[model samples]
Every structure is written in C-alpha cells, then in structure tokens.
Target: MTTPSERAARGREARKRVPRSSHGRWIPSAQRPDPLVVLEREAQDRLPELVPLRYGRMAVSAFAFLRGSAAVMAADLAAQRHTGLTVQLCGDAHLLNFGVYASPERTLLFDVNDFDETLPGPFEWDVKRLAASVAVAAFQNGSTKAKAHRAALVATESYRTTMRSLAKLGELDVWYQRIAADDLLPLVRGDERARVADRIARARRRTSLQAFNKLTETDASGARRIVEDPPLLERIPDIDRVTLGKIFSDYRSSLPEERRLLLDRYRYVDAARKVVGVGSVGTRCFVLLLEGRDDGDPLMLQIKEAGRSVLEPYLPATAYDHQGRRVVCGQRLTQAASDIFLGWMTGPEQRHFYWRQLRDMKGSAEVETMSPDTLRTYARLCGRALARAHARSGDRIAIAGYLGTSDVFDRAVADFSLAYAGQNADDYAALGAAIAAGMVTAAPGA
Candidate 1:
C-alpha cells in the first residue's frame, strides 16, 4: 500500500491537472432537466395529498425553492467536472441543514443536522451546495450581492482552513474533535453572540418532554395520546392495533441490545403523521410517543421514511439493501455523536424507515432574520462543521493538499455559488409561473 505521505503527494499532484480555478466555470447545458419536471418526478411516490404542501413551501421564496430541489442540484452537479475524491456527502448540505443539537453527553454540538439525501460523492459537491445556499439565503434575506458573495467566500475559506488544520492531526484526534456552541460563540460579537446564546437556550428547552407536553394531552378516561391538527399532524387510518404493535416491535429490534432493554421500560402509546422540514414535508414521517414509568415521563421518536438518496442516480448504488439502514449508517459516520436510539428497519410493505428522537435540544439557525455579519459568522461555522464531517470518512490529508493554503479554490467556489444562485432564481420563477397557470397548487402565504 502507498504510504500516507505518498497518497497526499499524489492528491496535490492531481490538483495540477484540474486546476482549482477550473471549478469556477459554470455553463448550463440545453439538455439539463427542467427543475419543475424533476421535482414532480421526485414527488411521484410521496403521499399524494401532501404533495401540494411541498410545492407550497418551495413556492414561498427562491431560497425555499433551492431547499426542496436537491435532486435538481444533484443532476446539475453530476454534469459538472469534479475531482474523483469522494466523501460521505450531506447530499443536501444547504445552509438551513446545519444546526445545534445535544450530543449524547447533553452538550450543545453544532453539525450537519439532515442526512436524508446523504451518500458518498465528490467532496466538492457538499461544499458547492452549502456555499450556494449561503448565497441564495443571503439574497433572500435582502443582503446585497456583495454580501452574498462574501458569505460564500467565508464558507469556502473556513472549510479549507479547518480541513487543513485537521489534516495535520492524527486520525484519532480528528475523530474526537467537535464544534460546540461555546467554541462557536467567541467567533461572533455583541448581538450575534447574544442571539446564538438565546438560540441555545431555546434549543435546550426543545426536548422530548417539551414536545410531549405540547403535542399530547390526557383524555377524560386518563389516557394520553397525541392530538391531531389538520394536514400537518393526523392519525393514520386503517392501521390495526396488532400491526402497530408489530411495527414498534420491529423498530425496537433494530436498536442496540442495551437500547432495546432500555426501550422495554417504555410502553408505546400513540403515533401520528407529523409533517416536518421543507424537503421532507410529504414523506411518511411519524412522531411516536412512548410512556416511561408514568404519564409524566415520555419519549418521542421520529420514524422517517427513507427513500433512495438524491445522489443515487449520479453515484453508485449503496451496498446496504435497505435504504433506512443506508441513512442510519451514513448518519453515524457523518455525525460526531448521533442519538442513542438511532436505528432503522423495513416496515410493512418493505417501506424503509429510520428512527431517532423526535426532538432533543435541536435548533436551526434563523437565517431569514439574520443580519449580514451574523450570516457571515454562521456560514463559516457551517463550513468548519462540514469539514469535520468530511474528514470523518474522507482522506483529509489528501483533500487538504488538493485545496492548498490559498484563496484560489475559495474564490472559484464563491463564483460558482453566485452563478448557481442565478439558476436557482430562474427555477424558482418557473415554479411560481406553474402555480399561477393552474399546473400546480400552492397554499396561500406558504
């Protein structure tokens, strides 16, 4: 086998053939798939009734449109020339997808929060997606084009710098490194720091018990169950009690033996179809409530349906037979410390599903209301967190060598983000036109 030093040397050499500046080019092909058509096809197998809600959410703004159109971006990225260095990609690594959540130790950790579309692909793909999201989000928040470009630049530069630093560390050291909220607060100043601290406070209160209290209530007979509220939260009809029991039992079997034993203490009480996230709105996601010891003690687990990743068509198929297992494994590999109850199983009719805490001190950046300076700080934090994730499965030394210690790759990626932001705007307009022409329906104010 080649030595580690030799591998990094080869990676540095590869960058010479495909100069970093070459990545700046973005000329769309006439053969590029229509964003609306691609989106419609993606929604084909999803719950038909909730499909309109998905479009409605995407129709809200250009940034919202970009958030839900991961497959469209994946197809476009596949058309671009990429370095063959693959990593565990947060395939939809948009700005809003990065967030703060509690690690197993109950510490506030910042990392990529979504892995529904995760897969192994070119490392640059995640960087590109994240950078473009910063541009798009900045513009949506009424920042100047220059500010948007700056955000992308900050993101790229931070990723490059952090990855290079991590590359110098031993493998075990890199694995143990984590970005906590306290570590991030110092990067901001005054109001931004105050804002992050407040957000952290809010997230700490967003635990399973909070959700249980807010979403469930007791009946006259003294039994507790989740309360339904229209299209967003409703009970699944026609599911027999035995089938429900089997589903919960099968999901428990997917957990670790110790977790299974711990789970046995809780009795399953209720499950509801709970719509969540802009991209995941139409999927079959359930909020399962389990009672532990007494009515006051509760656990809420989200069993989200897992489909083939958005990158599946562009990349090779996953080795895992079940898509849920694919998602669970990818989450474990990419996250610093995933939920203890994280597991996966194939449910009735072979629909794959992954299970995790429904809510556990989880909080996302409020990008919409962020000032330009705050946005810049957030962009860099996300980039650093993303670099850590990539380093987990990717060859960090080789990647760091390929990136080099300069702003060439940063400038190139920022330029590409600006260009792709234009494409995203065009796609957003087309969706709006489709909605206006009666080809699609969107909820008012959505």
Candidate 2:
C-alpha cells in the first residue's frame, strides 16, 4: 500500500496530466441539448420521489422545481467536460446562493451559502453555471446582452487571478484569510458605495437572538410556538414528527458531552413546518422552537431534508457513499466558519439535516437590481470566494497553471456563458411546453 504522502503525490501527478483547452476554439450551439428538456425530465423523475416530503404551501410549480434542477443541468454539463481535473464543486454556485451569514464565532462572513448538489467535478462546470446565472439575472433585470457578457468576463477573470494568487500562498494563509463584506465596499462605484456600506451595517445587526425573535412567537398558554401556514408551511406528518422528535434526542446524545449538557437545559416547546428557498422546495423541512429557563428565552433549529447530491450518480467514482454526510462534510470543508449545531442523522422516516440559527444577519445583494459597478464588485467578490473554496480541496498550483495570467480562460467562460444562457432559455421554454401539454402540474407563481 502506498503511504499517504505517496498517494498525495500520485494525485498531483494525475492532475498535472490533464489537458488544457486552446483559446479561440469554436464550440457550436448545436452540440448542446436544450436545457429545458433536460430540466423537465429531471423534474418528472424528482416529482415522484418528492411525494413523501411535500409539505403544504411548498413550491411545486415547474419554475420552482427548475430552480432546484442544478443537478440536472450539472449532469448534462459534466458530460461535456473538455479539460481540467474536476475539483469538488459547489454544484449550485449561482450568484444568489452567495450571501452573508454569521460564522460560529459570531463574525458575519460572506461565502457560498448552499451545497446540496456539491461534489467533485469539473471546475468549469461551476464557472459555466455561475456565468449562465449572471446572464439570466442580467437579462431578468433588463440589462443589455453586452453588459451581461462584460459582467461574466470580469467575474471569470477575477477567479483566474485569485486562484493564481492563492496557488502561491501557504496553506495556513489561504485558510485563515477570506474576503469579508467590509472588503467589498471600496470596490464598488462611487455612487453605489454608500448603499453597499449601509447594507453591510444592516447585516451586522443580525444575530442569533434576532433570528429567534423573527421565527418564533408565544401562544395564549405562553408556550413558544412556530408560525405556520398551508401549502407554504404546515405540521409535519405524525409519523415523521414522532420520528424526528426521537431523533433530536439521539442527535443531542451524539454531540460532544458539553454541547449535549448545554442542550439539556432547553425544553422542546413546539414544532412547525416551514417552506424555504426557491430551489429547496418540496424537501422535508421543519422549525423546532425550544425554550430555555423562561418563555422569553428562545432557540430555533431547522431540520432540513438532506438527499443524495445531484453530482453523485453522474461522477460515481468521486461520489460520497452517503449523500447527507457529503453535505455535512462539504459544508464544513468549504465554509470558513460553520454552525456549531451542524450535524446529520439517518432514521427510518428520512435522512434529516440539522442546523442552528437560520436567518442570522443573512443578506445578499440584489444582483438583479445592481447597477453595473455594484454588479462588478459583487462578481469579483464571488469569484474570489469560489477560488478560495476550490483551493481548499484541490492542488491550487496546477489549477493556477491551467489558468495562467491571460484572458484565454476568461474569454472561454464568457463565450460558454453566452452559449449556455441560450441553453437555459431553451430549457425554460421546454418546461413551459410541458406545463402547457398537461404533462406536469405546476405550483402557482412558480
């Protein structure tokens, strides 16, 4: 058996052997399939599997499902991976998924906030998804195609530059340093700088206590309660509810003794169903309200449905044996700071993801509403964050070498974005056709 050092060396050599694409090569549009058709097929497959977890008021529209269809898009795109060793990807590293959240240390940090589809795969798969998202967002905001193209180019170039820089840094330096919200203010245009500052300040005020307040309330009996509504939110099934209640106890037992002791101080006050996010619709998600000492002292925890990563089945060799564990492990690996309560459990009812302090000072720039300069600033920041994430899991030197100090990769991504955005539009159209043909029932306002 090879020693660990030898194994690492072999991995590095394999990465070095991967070929790089030449600049100015023409990749025809016809070579790509319609994105909507791909999306519809995925939606159809997932819809049946989602039956057990469809909470009331959840987003069931074709559009809602399409938002969560990154897995489908990823599989299609991975089939076209041309060059570069596939690194573990954020799978859904779109602009919107990049946002601000409090670290375990209570410092507000900006980084990728979602990783349901994360897996080891081609690096350009991420670049292409991000670029396509930029184009779609710009188009939605009524920006001209040229503006969208420019924004994509700037973002890709930032990724290239940052990856190269990180490749030269020591591991400790790369891991300890991150681009914070404050670091982005100066990069914005003069007119938008004030708004960005104000946003950051507002974000700073968000805390765990504040999140508890927003998501919880007291009933007539003065017991803590989680607010709920139909289709959007409802009580979990009795079987699932009972199973989850027992699992929470097991989860507490699984924590470090100190944390378990801290958790014992709180009483389970109430549980209610909640629907969250455009892409995460139809997944079993619940909010548990816990009370400590008095009714006034509250804690909120979310148990989200964790499923197999979309990238797993496609890239079978690199896929984790357990999808839920992959999510927990991937989140910890990629985020600079993660939730202390972050953990996973598999029960007979379903696999559940446990996390704490939802909506704590969480804020994202409205990329759709951004002016050109603000968009540039946001793009660069996300690019840097993406590079930082990739560096953590792969050999940065080889990636940097593949990128070099040139516009070749930038221009290639920009060209790919233009081509792929058209693909997404076509996919969106196919979803519309499926809805029109009565093939699938779409949720309202999806």
Candidate 3:
C-alpha cells in the first residue's frame, strides 16, 4: 500500500500537469497596472446594465450592491494577474461567506458556503476580493482605516501562514481537518474571547430540528408546506414547474443506485419560487418540499439556477465541459465535508443547477453586530479557512515556496485592499451617476 506522503506526492504530481496561467503571461506586481483602474472600467460597463433589473424593489443597500459588483471586479482582477498559478476560487469570498453549516458527519463546520461563481483563476484574485470585502465591511461598521488595516493585515498573515503550514502536512490531513466552532476561543483575543464563546453557544442551539420548525408549517389540510408571497416569492410558473417535475423524475437515473434508492423513499410535496442572496436575486430559484412515509416528516431542498461561471471564458482549457459540474466537483474537492444530498440536475430548457438542503442548521456570525475585537478575530478565522480551501486544490509547495516566511504577500494584499477600497468608492459614485441620469432604475433607497 502506498504511504500517505507518497500518495500526496502523486496527487501533487498530477496537479503539475494541469494548466496554470493567467491571460497567457506571468506578470509580476510591479509590471501590472493598478487593479482598481481596471475595476472602474468594468463596473462602468456592467453595473449600468444591471440597474434596470432592480425594478421597484428597494434599491439594495450600498453593501448589497457591492456584493453583486464582484463580477465587475472579477473581470478586472483577471486581467491583472501577477502570478502564473491559479486555482478554483470562491469568486466573492467576503467575510460573510464564512459561515456555520453542518458537515456530512453532522458536525457544525465553518467554511465558504457560496460557490456559484467558483472557477480556476489567479490565487491572488481571491485574496484581493477577500481583502477588499474586509475593507468595505469594516467601513460599513464605522471602523477606522487604521483598525481596518490592522484587521486586514491579520487576515492576510493568517492566510499566508496557514497555506504554508498546510503545504507541510500530508494531503489527507489537510483535507480532513476543517475549522470548527469549537476552535474559536484559542485564536480570539481579550474580551472578544468571551463574546466569541457566547456566539458559538448561540450557534449550537440551532439544530436541524430547530431549522425545520422555523421554516415549515402545516396547512389546514395538515400537509407540511412552505408558504410563499408573490414578487418577493411565489409558486414557480406552472409550465416551468411541470417541466422541472419531469426533469427531476429523470434525475434519479443519473444518481448512483444507492442514492437513487434513498431518493425513492421520498416524494416531491410541492415547489415554491424563492429569491435568494444579494447577487442571486434576479435568477430563477425554487424550494422543493419532500415528504417521506409520514406527512409530518419533511425535507426541504433548494434548486437554484446555475449560469456559466464568470471565469470560464478566461480559463485556458480544462477537462470539465459543464461549468456547473466544475463548481460542484470543486466544492467537493475543497470542503472537508459537504451536504450529503448535494447533487446536480439539468432542465429541459438546458439550464443547469446544483441542489441541496435549503436550511440544515445553517447560520452566520453577524459581523456588523460584532465588536471590533471580535471582527478582527473572525477575519483571521476566515483567512485561515480560505487558505485551507485553496490548499486542497492548488500546488501547495509552489505556493508556499512563493509566499515564504516573510509578510511581504500579506503587506502587499493590505496595500491592494486600501487602494481597491478607494476604487469601490469611485465605482459606487459611477453607479449613483447612472441612476441620476435615468440610465437605469434605482431601487427605492439606493
């Protein structure tokens, strides 16, 4: 049998054959133009196009707009790659993307929960997105630049150090150990330690049963149901609903025999239209209520519309043809444990989407409500988690070799973050201009 180290070496060697390039060149930082300048132009082009989609709904707050603005920034960041190696990335890995969800083992694990835009790209693209998010989040919370810089620096340092450490570990070890709520206290500082402990205690109270109770209700006929309201939420149109019903019936054929058996035990109860997340609001989404042998026993599944990955056209070349499949596969590769029911299905309309439990003991730390010290601690935690996720898919040794022991990369990220935050301000101004010019309908408050 192969030793674990030998197995890791083989895995690493396999990765070496995978193409790693950015726009066909290895441009270093000094040679690259300011990423912020590129971001501004992309935002000017894309953000105006999205405004008409907002309609009469309350203009999503500035913070919410920033989340959607990632596509613009992603385009710019991809154009300015300083490093040659890139890995599948969580395109908008902000502080909020780090959250608590149950692993397959039923343990509450903290990790990156969204993967809609995940794809292979320059590693620093992720780091830059994360850093700018920290700045935006801190600014929204009234944090001073100095304090925010301190937090950003801490986050970048944690990422650099954690990636280096993972580089030395056996591949399986790196893959198996994920950060848990139980690990927070040791890394927290001062009064924030007690606050983090309190938060974890609160998070622990939210179990699957608690989630079921909060989201499900029984109708007058005593059938378990998910209620819906129109515009914000509604039943999916009958034509599409019928088509999806047929597609889901065929979905069983794609699953393994054992998985098909498990799914066979439940029947689809109802499907309701739902809107979700800051960036995903306009996309088609639905919640499927599944009934087992008993009427009261329910399982809720969310089927979201998946589009082409924002990174696909930019990627050099790869074996995976479907961008949605690439996302699901990448998520499985990076997450220590994922939802057991996680799977993908395609519709007659040719759209692709991945499905999973709607809410299985899912919760997030309220960063806006957190104290500064706690925010700093949480930043470090998110940084470490991001590093671990990257290590699972990238060349850890080469990354570690590039990062070294010094704080150069950390400091560089901090600098980029400060500069990028300024760029976000400029983009936000341009968005305001588009709204003022009647080029697009602005949401109520926006």
Give lDDT tens digits, candidate 3, residues 193-298.
7876776666666653454566567799987666665444565544455775676765665456787788789877677777676666566677777777776567
lDDT of 2: 0.67
The number of the candidate with the highest TM-score is 1
Per-residue accuracy of model 2 over 97-163 as CA lDDT, tens digit each: 8988777677778888788787877676777677767766666566788987888888888888998
Q: What do the candidate models score in CA lDDT, each in turn?
A: 0.90, 0.67, 0.68
The stretch of ten residues in a row with the least summed lDDT in candidate 1 is 235-244
267, model 3: CA deviation in Å? 1.0
Error of 3 at 133 (Å): 0.6
All candidates in order of TM-score, best leading: 1, 2, 3
Stretches off by above 4 angstroms in model 3 are: 1-62, 189-212, 237-245, 253-256
User: Regarding TM-score, does 1 or 2 come out ahead?
Assistant: 1
Q: What is the lDDT of residue 395 in candidate 2?
A: 69
